[model samples]
Target: MATTGAVPMITLNNGVEIPQLGFGVFQIPPEDTKEATLVALREGYRHIDTAEMYGNEREVGEAVRESGIDRDKIFVTSKLNNGYHAPEAAAKAFEDTLSALDIGHLDLFLMHWPLTDGGYVDAWKAMEEMLQGGRVRAIGVSNFKQHHLNRLFAETTVVPAVNQIEIHPYLAQDDMRDFDREHQIATEAWSPIAQGKVLDDAVIERIARRTGKSPAQVVLRWHIQRGDIVFPKSVTPERVRDNFAIFDFELSDADMSDITALDRAERTGPDPDVFDYIPS
Candidate 1:
C-alpha cells in the first residue's frame, strides 16, 4: 500500500500534463545523480526535474534511458541556465541542454531565474520561439515573483506553463499560488520540504504520528492537498520510495490547515527579485 497507483497529472496552460509528484536533482552531484534518478524511477516516479544549473541533466537523461522507460512515457523538464538569459544565449543554451541530456525533446523548459537586469523578458521571447520550433513542449519560469510574472504578461505573447517556486510547510506561498491559478498556470513546488528544515516542526511531527506516515510524507501530502506540483529529492533509496508513497493517502481539511498555518514567509532559497547569481 505504499503507492495507490499512478501519480496525478497537472495539465499546463498549453495542454501538456506534468506529473504532480516528480524527482528533483538540485544539489545532487553529477557522479551520483544517475543512480539516484534510476532509484526514483524504479520507485514509480515518472517525472524527473533537472536543470543546466543543477549540473546533472546528463545523468538524469542517462537514468531515463537506462530505466528502459519510453521517452514519451516519462516526463522530463530542464531549465535555461541563469547566465544564459540573453535571447541568443538562451536559444543556444536550450540546444545545449537537449544535447547534454541527449533527450529527443524536453517536456518543459524554464527560465531558471528572473534576474534583476530584466533579461528574462527577451529570454522568454526566445523560449517562446523554441517552443514554436518544437524543441520544447512548454516554457515556464522558476523562482519568479508576482511582479516578474506581471512584466511577462504585459510584454510577452505566451503565458508561462508553470511556475516552480520554494514552498514548504513554513512558506505556503498562498498569494503566489493564487496568482498562478488566476492566470491558469500550474504551480510546481520546489524545496517542498524546505530541505529538511520542516521535518522537525512540531505540527508536522504530530500529524505524521497521527497518519502513520513519515514527516516528509505529511508535509508533501499537505502540498498535494493544496493542489501544487511537488518533487521531493533524496539520494537515499528508502526516502525516495517513501516520498512517492504520498499519493496513497489523504490529509483531512484540518490537517492541511494546520500545516498551512505554519507559514511564516520563510524561504530556504534566495529571494527571486534580487538573486542574481549566474553559475560559473
Candidate 2:
C-alpha cells in the first residue's frame, strides 16, 4: 500500500511496518522542531525519528498533534538515552519520554547505544517488559556493531527489531547489514546522506547529473534502493521537502554499484565500539 506516504515502508521483524524514508531531528532545537516537523508533514513525510537526547520530543509531538493527521497514520520514533540504561530507570525513562512527547505510545523506542557498562543487558530485559506491557510497539537499538549485537543476543532472549546506525554512501556498514539480516534485524540508517558530505562528491554528482536530480537525492535514493530505512535531518523547509523527493526516482543497478563503490568505512558520527566516551 506504500504505507500512506510519498515514501514506502518496510515491515519489521515484529510485523510493524515503518515508513522507509523518515524525517529526523538530530541537532535541531526544541523550539524549531515543531515548525520543521510540520513542514516535513506537509512535505508528505509520515515517519518522524527523534530521541530523548535530541530534547525536542515535546515539540515534535506538538507538531504531530497540530498537523491534524490521525495518530495511526503517522509513525513516531524515539530512543532511550545512554544514561538511562539500568533496568530500574528504563521504564521511568520511557515514561519521561512519553510525558515530554505528550503522546500515548511510541511507534518505536530504541536503546541509544550499547554500552560497556552492565546496565545495557538489564535495559534490554526491561525493554522486553515494556514491549509485552504495551508501552512501545517496537523495541530496537542504535549505534550497535556486530560485536555489540552478538553480545546482546548471547545474553538476551528478545532480539532487537532494528539497529539505527551511521549509514551513507561513505559508511555503508555492509558487514553489519549482513549480520543484521542473518539475525532478522532491520538496519535503519541515520545520517543516510553522510550529513550532506556526498552532495559534492564526484561520484554522486555524476549520477545526479545523469539522473537530473540533486546529489542529496542521489545519495538518499541509493539508500532506498539498498533497502535501508533512512531518516535524513534538515531544519530548512526546502531541504526537508527535497529529501523526501527521492521517492519518485529509482536508482539503477549500475548507479547503485557506483554509489556502493564509494564506501570508505568513514563515519561522520562517533564510533559504536566506544561507549565509554558517551556521557553519563
Candidate 3:
C-alpha cells in the first residue's frame, strides 16, 4: 500500500489542534498498555487516549516518554475518574494523573463520565482553573449527552473541547454529533467499531471488500469521513497498524450513507443518562 504521511488534525473551539485519529488504551490491562502504546507511536500515531478509570495512565505515559519521539510531538488525553467529580477531588485527580503519567503536562483532560447528580458545575470550575493555570491544554467531557452538555453550558465558563462518546455503525449518534458541531465541540467516537460487533456486519464487510480494506478499517474510515475524531483500540500488532492506516483512503458519499443507514440506535456501552456507576 502507498502512504500519505499525515493524520488529520481537528482544531477545537479554543484553537487547540488534535489528531483526528488516536490510540485508545481503554480496557487494555495496565501491564499490556505500555507495549501497546509504544507500538502505536512507532507506527505513526501521534495521539493517545487513556483515562484514570482505565488504570493504564502510568503505562501510557511510560510508553510516550520511552517512544524515542519528542514529547511535544504527541497529543495525550486522559480523564478524571467517576469518583472524582467534586471540585476538590477533581483538582486532586488531575495532579494524580500527571504524576501517574510522569508526563510534565497534559495535552487534554476530560471528566470521564457525568455521574448522577454529580456536581459537574463545580468540576467544570476546577477544570477551568487548571486550564487557566496552563497545565492542561484542553478540558472536555466523555459519555456526555446533550442535557449534560447543556447544564455545563448554562453553569460553567468554558465550552468543552471534546465529547468522547460511544458511536459506531449501529449507534451513529447523529444528534449528539450535530449538537457538538453546533457548539464547536469535537465529537470523539469511542467504541468506534461497536466493540468489534460491526466488523462482521454484512454492510460493513461489503464495503470492506469494495475498498480493499478490512471491515474494521472501513468502519473507522466512515467515522473519519463523517468528521468525528476516532481512536480505535487493538492490542494485536498487525491490527494496531491497520487501524492507523485509515488516513490514506476515502469513503464515497454513497458508502457513507449506506453505513449511516445501518444505524439501529444500538449502544455497546452504558447510556449516560441513566448510568450512575461510581468506581471504587
Distance from true location, Cα of 233 in model 3, Å: 1.0
Q: Model 2, residue 110: displacement in angstroms?
A: 0.2
lDDT of each residue in 88-112, candidate 1, tens digit only: 8988999999999997989999898
TM-score of 3: 0.97
Q: Which scores higher on TM-score, 1 or 2? A: 1
lDDT by residue (99-149, candidate 2, tens digit) is: 998878899999998877657788889999989988689999998888788
| Residue-pair clashes per candidate | 0, 0, 0
Off by over 4 Å in 2: 1-5, 277-280
Q: Write down the TM-score of every candidate.
A: 0.97, 0.96, 0.97
Candidate 3 C-alpha lDDT tens digits along 1-280: 1112578888888988898899999999999999999999999999999999899999999999899999988999999888887888899999999999998999999998887885777888999999999999999999999888999998988999999999998999999999999999999999999888988899889999988999998999999889888988889999999998886788899999999999999998998888888787
Q: TM-score ranking from best to worst?
A: 1, 3, 2
What's the lDDT for residue 36 in model 1?
99
